[model samples]
Target: MLMDDDLFSSRPEDPLASLARQDLDPLSQHELDERIAALEAEIARVRAHSEAVAKHRSAADALFKR
Candidate 1:
């Protein structure tokens, strides 16, 4: 049976943070490792998005500057 930790994690300032954080005491070392991996993946995704948005904004500003 899949528990909540198997289905969820805490990180990245998402709507998940609006909800109460789950207790970490019940997690095993393996589960904590998995959570770390998930958060890392999310960080990469967010960085990529930020980079793209910054590039687009820069281009827009240059266009308007001309």
Candidate 2:
């Protein structure tokens, strides 16, 4: 009974074994370029918005302190 439980409890297949045999889909050069450009634009927008918020917060705090 113990041996039977051990056999059942053991992982049936290795995930890495399957990964070793898998083929990855190739992305086109155009698609890769577009994705990179989109990510850069998004990062720039987020940084600008963050700076604006920090400036507003600083102004508000100075007013409150006076």
lDDT, candidate 2, 1-66, per-residue tens: 368868787667785587456554565788769867976898899999999999999999999995
Query: What are the clashing pairs of model 2?
Result: none
What lDDT does candidate 1 reach at residue 53? 100
- Give me the runs in candidate 1 sitting further than 4 Å from their true place: 1-14, 18-20
lDDT of each: 0.85, 0.79
Q: For model 1, how does the per-residue alpha-carbon lDDT over 1-66 read when each residue is reduced to its tens digit?
A: 998976685544566774348788998999989988998899899999999999999999999995
RMSD of each: 10.1, 11.1
Judge candidate 2 at residue 8 and give its lDDT: 83
